[model samples]
Target chain A: MADTQLEADVTVNAVGSSCPGPLMELVGNAKDVDPGTVIRLQSSNEGTEPDVAEWSEESGNELLDVVDRGDHWDLYVRIDD
Target chain B: MTANRPSVLVLGAGAGGTMTANALRRRLDADVTVIDKGRTHRYQPAYYLIPFDYMELADQERDTRELLHDEVSFVEDEVTGIDPDDRRVEGEADSYEYDVLITAVGNDRRPDAVPGMLEGWNRTDSVYPFYHASAAAALGDAVDEFDGGRFLVTVPDTPIKCGGAPLKLTMLMEEHIRKRGLRDDAELVMTKPGAEVFGTGPKAPYQERIEEIWDERDITFVPEFTVSEVDYEEQVVRSAEGDSLEYDLYAPVPPQYGHEFVVENSPLTDGGEYVSVDDNTLQHETYPEVFALGDNADVPTSRTASAARKQSHVVVDNVERYLDGRSPAPDYDGYTACPILTEEGKAMIAEFDYEDSISAPIVSRLNWFLDVNVIPSLYWNVWMRGYDPVP
Candidate 1:
């Protein structure tokens, strides 16, 4: 997925949050949105990729893509219906 | 006019409460008071170092009253309940009223939460929960007598104050064993409930370095081991998944939780283990006049004195603002730090806030010196006195 082309319904800026912080923020924000809503999570913590991946798989959410932004990462996820 | 002055009541006289009270007393013209059940304030970071005889237990202890500012009143009373609605705190000795309340009562170590753990500590000399001051002292003797065998250190599933303490203790023990020429006979092992040795994210660099260090030193790292029971009779620690590891000596970090009064009696927590506060502002969610910091606050960060020191500045600022009829700002960034002692003389610092890792992941003797030599002095003189120059 092209970074500029894709858009998200919600963007969670957990830039400096480590491990569970970014994942927690993503989950918290995802809960308020409707099912199938695409959310973008920005994080600086390296553990977020695998954690979000595992969480998405376990929770039956769609992990659209993970883009590395030099200093941080932007992970896209779609809430399960 | 005197009655119009706002009164601030702080719960617990530990690092958080003392710093909060002292800072508030210095900043505000309000009546600042600290209530705690314990008489002595212990430097808890030294608990791991105490086992190695690196720090004296007596030196780490101070009278709670002595730590507070002269303007701040110290009440030695066990808190029984908190009525946030009426703004009253009930203690075993007396009841007190406050215009503003700040709960900083730290975690309670519960060894009995795990079956046979308490018995092992009491009946056998093999088990030690080094988180407790007395237990840490006792572990010193145990370490001295241990010549060779499987030396095991376990971390609890609960949220502990210093998350890196068990790792530090494990590494220090490995170094001690190697120096004693017991390296061949001694098998050093550390266990955590999670996959990561320390933690992931901002702690990744430090964790990677720790992994390499452990591999080089022949120290065993066991992950996903949730301590279910400590079998004293068999000298083994069993995990929730039915896996068991036999040990000649054991040092386990016991499960920790909030005080019963705060968790059960007070509506401040809203049926949670910690006080339900706005994580950023450090203010109580429902009560504008209430704030929380330290281990008792439900903030998603590692509980440490460093974190409390940072929170003190925010809490004090917000409390003063609230008294002056101003809205509290979301200034706190969930910053916390852990100085991971890799060996006897070398250490690495993992410092981070909500947004990013602040410290470089490098192990050095200077880090050790700062942690061992400098931080404690600063903790007592500057931090406990609420003379923090760095926010």
Candidate 2:
């Protein structure tokens, strides 16, 4: 099966955060989760959604889904390595 | 001595040090330790206007106590030594150990950098360096009482916080003389060490603007002339290259140097005597637990508060990584920012990284407005609070 949130073992909640907040939160939480688990980042910094997801994508993590809920964004990423 | 929490000792409470302490407290749960020698913290940018009644020096300074809160453990003491191997910093009255140490002790203006800079300062009113709060008061007195003559500003072969400050004073004085209807009577000359006016090539708009003002105001530009002597009595400034410029009113920026504690304590500093850290990680090359930022770091860039704010991110990140037992992700792009104030109304905000690359242009009033009003408030509020607007 294709690797996605469906096969994920972890989830990260980085809600109510902004630019560096979301990224910082994600980076900090990324260390604790097992290598294959998924981290779901939620934040209101619309400007940093693509940035966070891109950072995750480049750093050996699989960006599963990015959803903008107007008030905030839910960035889903599965830690591949 | 008996804090309930482990302390994070921060040395120096100036722009870089203050920002580092405040930012650390806001981000981490550890106890914050801030040490500085002075009871008063002066907002230095306002010094440019103090001579011309644009701002007050007293208004620029704040009770250092008013700036700190319950979040930080404040110590009014001068830093004497730092035992990085022992992880302790020696203050005037106490020695405190730190879980993490941040060196924000900023640069000091040395009147002795040039041979006769200090001598001229005491011997004549014609020579003044915009290096301290006192210099502004002295220069203000000089500007107000002068009737008319040649007002000269010489920039030494050293790096200053605001690169354009000396020249900015030159322009404002030209405006001051013009307003006083002494344009024909007063001749303004800027003696500088560099070839360009604004430093960045992209800021040609600013360079052209300054040159235009120089032409219109009849202010002469002397480039690459390092000041050698200040003959207060003879009213002459001799460049090290044997060039000479005469002036009735002379303003110069004193040479800057690193703190003695750092130079004497650590082997990290170069001949210029700054903490030689990798610009991106901000961690000491030989020591991982030690990190430095701001004016003290030997980062080849314009030393300004704007640069410090950007460096704060890198410092914060590397510190967090070190706390997490992971190798630092080196990502500091040597970002630096400066707001070149053309006048009371016009300001050009310049932001760039290690390459003199422009991050933001001078077109926006928001950035200028940030420099004039917003950033200063945020510096006192958020930056001092250990919180940064990182978006």
- Compare the candidates by lDDT and give the number of the best one: 1
Q: List the residue pairs that clash in candidate 1.
A: A16-B354, A16-B355, A16-B356
Q: Model 2 — interface RMS deviation? A: 22.8
Q: Which ranges of candidate 2 are over 4 A from the true structure?
A: A1-81, B1-6, B200-205, B270-272, B359-370
Q: Which lDDT tens digits does candidate 2 get at residues B1-391?
A: 3354446777777777777776777676678777876556778878887888767766677766677766777887667677777888886568888877778777767766677666566445567666555566668778877789898887778777777788778878888888888888888888787787666554555666667766866878888888888777788889878889888888888777787778886555754578878877888877677778888887877787777777777887777778778898788777776676655566666666676556544535565576767766777777766677754
* TM-score for the A chain of candidate 1: 0.93
Using Cα atoms, each model's DockQ against the true complex is 0.01, 0.01
Clashes of each: 3, 2
In model 1, the runs with Cα more than 4 Å from the true position are A1-81
Estimate, for each residue in B298-356, the C-alpha lDDT of model 1 and write its tens digit.
99999999999999999999998998899998989999999999887899999987767
Q: For model 2, what is the error of residue B189's alpha carbon versus the real structure, in angstroms, after optimal superposition?
A: 1.0
